[model samples]
Target: MKMAGKMDEEIDLGLAEELGVEYEPYKMSDDEVIEALRQINKEVPWEIPVSKELLPYLRPTILCEAHHPEIREEALRIVEGAETSIDAAMMIFYYMISRIKYAMEPPKTSPDALRTRKGNCFTKAGLQIALLRSVGIPGRYSFDKTLLKVIKIVVPREIFEKMPGKFTIHQSADAYHIERRKWIQCDTTFDEGLMPFPYNWNGKTDLLLLCPWWRLGHVGKSPYFPVNELLGRFKQRGFTKDFCAREIDPFTEHLRTLSIQELCKHYKRTLGRRDADSFAHILYFHFVGHFRDVHYNPLFRYDTNLEDLSDLQESGLRIFEPKYSVEKFEEWSVSGIPFEVE
Candidate 1:
């Protein structure tokens, strides 16, 4: 797959040239890119038709490096036994989420996220898109304005306090399902351990409910990775690594005080019944069963030595909180009036 001519200035110039595609190092300004995204959002149909038009979605970009040898090889392994595009897409989505643990301040690119095995919504979406595209499945990044209530639930109060009252950029991914002949949206932000039992995607309908937030609107879709947009919007408003490190202990402590019943209600109201019950179990395991930290799920992180209750208490809870912070947000950024919606 070749990088689209329009995207030449946006992608890695050296890589594009190495692949025998036309190349330019600097083409579009950040402003130009943003305007182009606005146009792309306006022009592209949500139900993207299957055609050569999807070529851009499949091509490698700086952020979504589908052409990377490692990414391509991993994608092949993940979908080795898949019989159809839908199955491959599903396998890729699950594999991406399973590899990357959900966290507040994640890596910006797919390769970094894959290396660290930790990321937030945007990074997860980016990695998933890269993986899908690596296997010849056309994929794109999605952007949206979503409520802070979803974030407030997972993070510590101190971090949440610095955040906007509502409406921050929420990201997800879309993979073109060959059988359905359309793009299927999948929010693989939360991994299996953090998710409920019944949550799934069939590659026909949107799998957006995996997240705890309701979508508000921003750049609804993009043919390429939207990581730069996320950085531009959130960077000035972001907190420092020191701030996140100081807040990690408080966040970890606060997890213990979280009311199971209240969490269940929140999950049920936002995510659905299955998530509610599953989250409750996770909390139950931590608090009552004496698991060290609710966040440390061995399945995703590859942590072999889970300390026993007595050993855990002595060593202290070790939550792998991301050191950086993207928590800064302002209400006025999204709407002139403060967001009052629950």
Candidate 2:
């Protein structure tokens, strides 16, 4: 039975079978992704629907909420072990960069990211933020629209084709440098093996720094950033109050019991009836990377370039090398059943 949110006719079955991830490929443009959010602005209730069968494990993790005491202290200890302040910050960054593999794990708290070492950019950044703040390293959200192509290194091509070529709203974290008194954009999104690849990041430049100067999601016009006006009226407020970690913890054990295939089947069916707006939100925040594209927020995006930060190597920044190697690339992708293409 097809659910209300029909898989766009473009779903590629053979490719899905080949990739071992079940998704109906329907080609959508940037506009469609943008429009999906509009439903959120209007009078529709914003929520991720959970089926009765999976209700025990369907609680969503609040990605924006920060500062878990125990987790922060543990991260602080790791930072304290480092020789210098910058070294400490980079140590935190390295742990976050090294630990996570971009995938479809439900958004979890900072402690969860460290404990599990698997999540998309949002959860990974939560760990980074928690660790940085514990050691007095200032950090904030730096959301931007990024090309989906950049993710090709990690995502298989056939699955990648289903999504828009560009994600107009992608995110990473920005951390302040205490000694130099500059905020460095430490984009910690790419996975373990793919970390060093040029598509993911280079040792130098802001190419991978994800950050923001002020509270993002504020409304302002931008010829370059398309969704400026829609930002203010569209995104709901006080939504985070409902996304607490403690509230979600009850569902964790139950969620762990399901196979990835079982979980995805539930996600597809429950979300099938969702209107485009909630659908987009689910696709980004809940299902994969948090790629919400609220229009007004982009104006606050701090401009960054691929400037080399090699001079800051003294800050403990260095190239990434994966400790464990994958024997088969295809196996690596399938092992993590729920992840995005870009």
Candidate 3:
């Protein structure tokens, strides 16, 4: 089976090279190579089949947008600046968390939603990979499933016994591993001083239920997934869905109508106390908080140990510093916003 897998990979690479797909030929292990190929294959449009000559360029375009001169230059700068493992890790984290802003309202693409900073986990991961690649580093995005169980509130034991079903939510975190290097887990959308260590988990990990949003449906169920389909459905009904979708213009207008405090209040009411707390932790740690039903899981939880940066550094892991100086961002303070819904 291993030999066959190797043969299959060689065939794919040969085909990709023949098609002129611009890709980095990294000397990775077979497993790493296969995984990278899988990611590339999954992301590119296979329907509009390209000539073997075109495959090389296809990857560079899809992966790095190398054609964009400015992006290319910035990516190179990031790569050039990394002098150590800590520097590299911090550079990637700071760039994604501080530079890429989380949209007040969802936008279609990371590049398009240019706030002071903006991106989802995917976009942030892409940005980090692009920067890493530009500097001659090999990195790939990875994900894993984690088990989470909801905590019981101050209810009588008898009352709790009457509740139906197990409480749990599956959440995803994106990470990139360098060849012979450590893997860094990043929640770009999370804020500083708000998360725990080993940023990504591989097995049955326990998480804290900080926000109701974390308890929502699975990943693709969020507005970020099938955004257009959901928005179209909303539009057909005169744009009346209570939950926000990716209608940038309308979403921006909606944001404008609510103060930061009002927005927090609305979120609290929608998510409830425990869930809201978890959401706040996400905001404080990852910086990429967004509203999604999947994030609203009753079982959403986080490890308090992961919340400390000092602990992470002591464990020989590097944490990224915030991109923006705290003073600069504090001007738009949403700190006073209550964690629970009104």
Candidate 4:
């Protein structure tokens, strides 16, 4: 199997080289590029998709409205009779980690995740956010750079080190605490004996939820992206999803067959840098593809008919309207990203 996979990779690279595949880096004007991405992000078409008479979750997305009746009810049940919202929130976060085993994949609908009892960092983050949004809590995706680097561990040191550098972003949940009057980072991807959950409730600082487990000294998910802390970085990271799928995987494979000096020469001429910035347009697309249901999942690639959506609609106490538009974007600058959406 290993040899076959390696041979497959070699063929892919040979095909790329024969076709004149190579990187051509250029400085993208931040304003023009970001505006284009923001437009694309907003354009993912959505509609009621079902009769307004049915369940809440059944309705299609309008940005952060990922809430569903089951998610809300379960979250409320776990936070069972908490005296304060904070306590309730804490309980819900705990329930997320305790219940879901960690895996690596793009997020799925809350019910699917709950039924399976497993998901990647993205799934974990999505689960937490669904709960938060379901119960009327305000939240958004949080993207962190320094934190994303910890994900390098998942790639295997050999393949990971061979890449230009850290491929892209890491994300988690962020929620607003009303009484505290601030946003808190809810790193639910891991469960520490303590949270090893030491965030001081000040609502300002982000508590690194599983510092010891990840790092040995600190590291990686329940699959959440940080909020717009770095906008350009967000665009940069999202843009990588497409770039690597189209360019890097085979290019990297081709590089594997070359001598050190040949690799360096190829690197400078084709990639333009010896840093993550070189293949900055790329991410290990496979890292997320194994689980992302884009092509297979109806809810993602195709809209469900009115009847099927009825089963998936929201049946909750409250329908938390999204405060932010799905179109919200910015903080990072990504160059060489074409505005094309497939």
User: Which runs in model 3 stand beyond 4 Å of their true positions?
Assistant: 1-69, 78-81, 102-121, 143-180, 189-246, 252-260, 282-342
Residue 177: error of model 1 in Å?
1.0
Best by lDDT: 1
Deviation in angstroms for 253 in model 3?
Answer: 6.8
Query: Runs in model 1 with CA error above 4 Å?
Result: 1-51, 210-213, 240-342
Question: Per-residue lDDT for 108-129 in model 1, tens only?
Answer: 5566667767667776887898
Candidate 3 lDDT over 102-135, as tens digits, reads: 3322212223322224443344444554454333
Q: Candidate 2 at residue 293, lDDT?
A: 22
TM, every model: 0.59, 0.41, 0.40, 0.40
Worst 10 residues of 1 by lDDT: 326-335
Off by over 4 Å in 4: 1-65, 147-149, 152-164, 192-205, 209-342
Runs in model 2 lying further than 4 Å from the true structure: 1-66, 196-342
- Global lDDT for candidate 1? 0.53
Give me the candidate number with maximum TM-score: 1
Worst lDDT 10-window in candidate 3: 1-10
lDDT-better candidate, 1 vs 4: 1
What TM-score does candidate 3 reach? 0.40
Residue 298, candidate 4: alpha-carbon lDDT: 13
